[model samples]
Target: MEATPQAPSPLEETQRSGLALGLVVWVFSLLGVLGALYARWAWTPHSVTVEGASIQHLFDVILAIILVAFVLVHLLLGYFIVRYRARGSESALYFPHHTALEVTYTAVPAVVMVALSVAGILLWSRVHAAPPPDAFVVEVRGEQFGWSARYPGPDGKLGRVDNRIQRPFNVDPEDPAGRDDVTSPEIYLVVNRPNRILLRTRDVQHSFWVPAFRLKKDLLPGATTELVLTPTQRGEFDLACAELCGVGHYTMAGKVRVVTQQEFDRWLRQQGRR
Candidate 1:
């Protein structure tokens, strides 16, 4: 004979009411969190570089993955809470393991992680790749309190400055090639032209950073580091040190001036053959 349906006890009805209320509150809370996150995303300062744009795209992909996981987990948690709520008539069901479910969860994450790593490696290689042969070269020196820039003289060659020759002015008086080098208080570049910067530090370690160009590199005392980029837009931007070198680290700053090719040539001439 089939079992007859029985009415729920008054206490059981109260428990169900409470469970429903809790579920509504929890779901609304998740929605509120989602809304807040969206608002934060809408209002944020951003970097303006071709590579930086690509990096942001990568960030979005990772964020999407995280969000999907978040929503799925929350839904499951809510489902379990409602489905197995305290009911006197029902008993628990136990299954040790589900092979397909386990395999799916493991395999999906492994695939996603591998894909992300591969994409990151490709982007890294592209950004760090060699600049073209016709690229113009510039030199930058990071010091305790400020930065010094050097442009190739009329010879279109940067005079070599040895790291061993440390002095008051941060330049070697002995190198003839470097004698013609012009040190500028700021970095000036022609828009849309490839500029490769040679980086060095005078006393300690420092990092050369320009946000708009999405370029940064460490300046070590005894070695030279290189960063290459081409400015697409004409604007003035701040160049900052990303490292904590010492007491005057906050003052270690510079500027990037992206101008027309003609203007850049004229400015170089104005600096003259130093």
Candidate 2:
């Protein structure tokens, strides 16, 4: 006796195609997630400030949780897709929502969100609070394409700045405190010392950023901003306007050199007191 063969049914054909599509999606998603993780780990910059280090640590903690969750979810999804995949002549099961499962999902995410918020606020408070009373002071005014820095003279006090005093550039020449201020093309500070920087803008808006210190603050027209930092490393770090201010935004660049107290004093003297 010989056996007879029959063609696949429409249902079987649909099931076959669905499984193929599921496998392709799973493979591509896994690859994409892995590639992103590797790239992020490869080129992150090193932090030179204690505050930046703390922030980076928090970021790492969050990233680790995210990566683990990502891998687990994708794996579980792939497993279910294959384990309970559609088959010809199979009847679907009816299932209803479970209150316990729903509550678990909602409560877990809410708790995680609250924890992250509290941690961020605590970290911000440590870094953004008032600077030490004896902290070194510096003033920075950003223009369309350049940065002008001022250091308090012997009196150790910055002058009262009135942006309206001058148009393109600002000053109150008669404000005696400002008369002896020293100007520098780039900002400089003493390593391991708290620094209070009073930021101003000459024309439009700009951002004063120090990547190594993880510090960035906007410089608004006719408004003053204060930024505090305590650099723990001695090195020349790059600064740039994080905001787009004008046609020269791409060329807007500055550098901050964190040096020893002796070197900072020497640098101020070289600039010549006004």
Candidate 3:
């Protein structure tokens, strides 16, 4: 039997409502993108250090360029969709691929990648270069859920520490270095000085992250990892565990306090006397 055409009812109203809602969503999405671009461009720089300023400025430029390109691409795409929508009597045009257009697009991106890579490498080298002779050395140990730090005394030579022989709240009876090493829950450092952090994990992987300083390094079991950071600004920064540990992943939070050399010394002396 031939099918009969159905008359429109409340169901047709529902369809229209859905279409209107979809349009609203699309428009809001475009506005959301614009808002994000504005926020990124107008963000204030909080860290006054050179390294921090460089990172913020670099990201701002990169994000602005990306947002502009994104906006242009979408604008052209929307225009094409409306301009070339199917009509009752018209057929679609067919064209062969343009080699010139492909080459131009590929070359531009290649040139951009090369420039970005060079700049990244230079920044990395600046952060990871070997510390000077007077640089402060600190050893960091990661256990299941906490960080323990050890600072070499005034001698500047890190007394050796073997975790196997070391006990909680007490130094190992065997390792001689544990006698002079300063261990604490708080990882302290002297600002405006070259500081090297030696990282190690006892059980699983952990990451030493200080967002303010823009520094992060993984802490692995057995082997020791190291990263150099010189904090030129003095303030309190949040340190988070970058790697996913277990159910306690969300609770792994650490504090980073950047202070002057004099304050650091006072804190160190107080800890030593304890």
Q: Which structure among the candidates has the greatest lDDT?
A: 2
**Steric collisions counted per model:** 2, 0, 0
lDDT, model 2, position 90: 73
lDDT over C-alpha atoms for residue 227 of model 3: 79
Q: Which ten residues in a row have the lowest lDDT in candidate 1?
A: 39-48
Quote each prediction's TM-score.
0.79, 0.89, 0.79
> Is 1 or 2 the stronger prediction by TM-score?
2
Angstrom error of the Cα, residue 69, model 2: value is 1.6
The candidate maximizing TM-score is: 2
Model 3: colliding residue pairs: none
**Which residue pairs does candidate 2 place in steric collision?**
none
lDDT of 2 at 236: 92
CA lDDT, every model vs. true structure: 0.78, 0.83, 0.73
Residues 174-253 of candidate 1: C-alpha lDDT, one tens digit per residue: 76766677887778776777778888877899999886666678998888899877776788888889999998899888
Model 3 ranges off by over 4 Å? 1-29, 38-50, 168-178
Residues 144-227, candidate 2: write the lDDT tens digits.
Answer: 799988888877877777766762235577778876677778788888988888888888999999877887999988898989
